[model samples]
Target chain A: MEFLSERARQKLKSALLILSFFVLWEVACLVFKVSEIVLPRPTVILGALWQFFPGIRPHLIQTLYTTLVGFALGVGIGVVIGAVIGVSRVAYDTAYPLLVGFSSIPKVAVVPIFVLWFGAGTTPAILTSMVICIFPIVVNVATGLATTEPELEDVLKALGAKKLDILWNVSLPRAMPYFFASLKVAITLAFVGTVLSETVASNRGIGNLMMIASSNFNVPLVFAGLFLLAGLGVALYVIFSLIERRVAGWAMRKQDFAMG
Target chain B: MMAAKPDTFVPALPPSAPERARPLISLEGAGITYGRGANAVEALTPTDLDIDKGDFVALVGPSGCGKSTILKLVANLIRASRGHVFVGGREVGAERVGIGMAFQNPTMLPWLRIRDNIMLPLKIVEPFRSEFRAKRKTEFRDRAEALLEVVGLKGFGDKYPWQLSGGMLQRANLCRALIHDPALLLLDEPFGALDQFTREELWAILQQLWMDRKPTVILVTHDLREAAYLATRVCVMSARPGRIVADDAVPFARPRTLDMTFEPEFVALTQRLRGLIVDARTGKV
Candidate 1:
């Protein structure tokens, strides 16, 4: 530990911290004689994950596909609607409160409506994911455009710039950092929307796998499914994070030092 | 509106000569009142001014004197409630004519590289706008580099705005404002955010740019010395519901330097303007 560099030390510390939690979980489960039906040991969950890996592959793929489709649509529509709302005061005043009200309805509750409308399958899952994830993107993009410095707008206007020119040259670029931030949040929520709908209405995906495993008292398999979903969420988050770094690294320059 | 035109004997000049010789920008009894009647607040009183072609004018007054409002009026960013604002002898229209602007903050797009930020205007304003896509990359690069060189940022165009110091950013800001070779430039306390040393340095930079191009410039500032040093004419505005109370012509010669601020006449002029602003602030006219 003493020989380790500072960054290595930090990584080691984090690893040890996470490792200690699992160690405590395994020991507590065994020592307390906790019923395996209620909670399985970390090793048992790992064993189940390996054993069920082949069977869970299709479910994992289905979940990932649905989430990605929904997220893509959410981002596409969010950008257009957000830009329209942000650019026009009349549209903003009219749409903002309605959006706020609509987003307030729990997306989980809407899953049943989606099910009734589309039946229990990928359609409901995708729509639910889109519904849950689009709000943050709209909020962020609209805020970015709405807050464009009036002075900057004046500069462009004085140059004979049309509304479209300002949006392309100034507003949209200004929204990138906000847009990327929303992507990170939206991607995570995309998973939630997918899984919630899958649990309620879909016959496929990890959500359905976990539900079936739980009913069969296969606690370890359920934990395995949860871990798989977490892994997928983390992988998607990291991909977006990498994209964010490449596209908008300049914005994070000051934040990097502060975070360190 | 009823003020009579003087009857003078005359005419060696062409009939349209007098009209042609009229100032490039004029606000004739132009004013702005925000909101509707009853609750409306008059931000600017009916004001009259004329800025000749290539003249450098500075508007100096208190915080709410509507000095910046006058800049906006000239740029046609806002309409005058009472009368007309004429640019190039025509009434100001919704469509913008050639005008460039810079503010106290650099207002550089953080996402854009310094060079691209400077090139933004050309990509929008026409003649250049229509050809920007077809022009060789090197042509745009050369123009940006030339402007950057003038601002002492020759090799730094690839850097982001965040990477530059405050003074360097302001330099880029000035370059962006001038990149289009506009007929008129509007500056709203362009150096107000910098420290004294940097502010003085930028004054020299701006002075050089103005000298080289001779665009019609209207600077709005609280710093009387900045107004006195940079402008050929300094106009003082009264506090709220602002109206110009004094329009003093600066007598300093061209290529003025920092040393000139210490000269007796420069000191006297700045002090006089300062006193006028104080009186304006106190509602004493």
Candidate 2:
């Protein structure tokens, strides 16, 4: 109800921006008489989106399932490997060079290899996402775990804590803020990785649908796909941010106080 | 140097009677060096100490004088370069237990609730560990609550560490250390962060905790009065490559209150330790 409320203002501004964009696009099309195949107006895009909402069922499900599989597998593997590497000096030392190299090589370059290994189906897409979505968690958690302060460690030790006990208590809790810091980045990458991998190889997902729409010069469908991807990204990021806010309450409070 | 007084450097420890219960911890010919040869800095050189059961010992010296190193040696948190550390008459070869420690900064786990932070040791240390989540666990909670009560933090159990003031956090920090009822409580200047009044207030709380718990305490501090008031014996060290210079015992007795700070005996002993630190400062020790 309040005029200056942040959420209301934000929503109002976004609605205005979208409205103006559509208006400009319509005017540009009218003035130039741009072919609909080349550049569709907002109304056409909306119509395509309406059609898409119904026809996208089977493909959307397939794409989403494959994407999520890749994302989850990547996260699972990344966390376990990262924790081991993060905690153990010898393990980290042995793995560091290889991980560094793996991190450097662009994940996009591996699509063909994954395709050859797993075939041009959901497997390849999932594999690509798995490869692409893991690094941030590994890097972030490892960094967080390694750099816990010595004095805290000593206190835990003096309290007669077993090594595992200290790890569970001080090191793990201390690493939480850093974990969430990286998780926010990691989750978004997972989503993107899935979508991109699907785009390259998927048959039923939004990505494949986009490719189909683009090649056929169905501009509204392409715009529809783009808009959906953007929405997904925003939604996922907002969800992760909420989780971060809860898990890292202390860090947020200090930041908020410091900002004020 | 003659042993100054009975109540000064030794507490009335119930377990210390009859059997010569070997000192809670001992440092024998301890030496620590950083680096080697021409570049080596010998941080501590052949230091010896017998911190008695329930005696509050203060290791005070100028910066870089290895005051912290002495506490480390006693805790067995680090190895001595050339000597041995003993706790409860055995080599610190993994059987040593019941050592609670605190540092200058309040190192509470930022994510955990204050109750969880205090209950950490119970969840870690043996006897308490296996039975923690099992047996009612009310005992551990009561123990934490009692310690918090003693530290004047009765209702702050659920609040996170960040939500508390520095003084309150440090009190909770010390409580977490003492929760396991360790025989040797090692405090490295626990009140160094609080204001003057707050620091003095914490000293009284610390004294009462030491009095009630009767743990062998090694408090590393730069404050001479803190050393005098809280410690049974104040061990002064020389600068840089440090060794004990003045090992003076206080003259005051138990049931010591804030009023004792105004007494002549307290003043004289405070002045005496002050002179020893100055003696250490001038290389006069």
Residue lDDT tens for model 1, A1-260:
35347768888999999999999999999999999898999999999999988999999999999999999999898888788888898989998898899899998889988889888999999998898788899999999888889899999988888889988888887788889999999999999999999998878998999999999999999999988888888999999988887776667866452242
Best by DockQ: 1
- The TM-scores, one per candidate, come to 0.92, 0.88
Specify the highest-lDDT model's number. 1
Flag clash pairs in model 2: none
Q: For candidate 2, lDDT tens digit of each residue in B1-285?
A: 111243333433466488676676778898899899999999998888887778899988878889898888777677888876666665663445688899999888877778888888788788888889974258878888888999999999978787799999999998988888888888898888889888988988988888887988899998877888888898889876899987888868875677788788888877876777677777776
Sequence-dependent TM-score of model 2? 0.88
Query: Can you list each candidate's DockQ?
Result: 0.74, 0.68
lDDT by residue for model 1 (B171-193), tens: 99999999889999999999998
Task: Report the lDDT of model 1 for residue A139.
Answer: 90
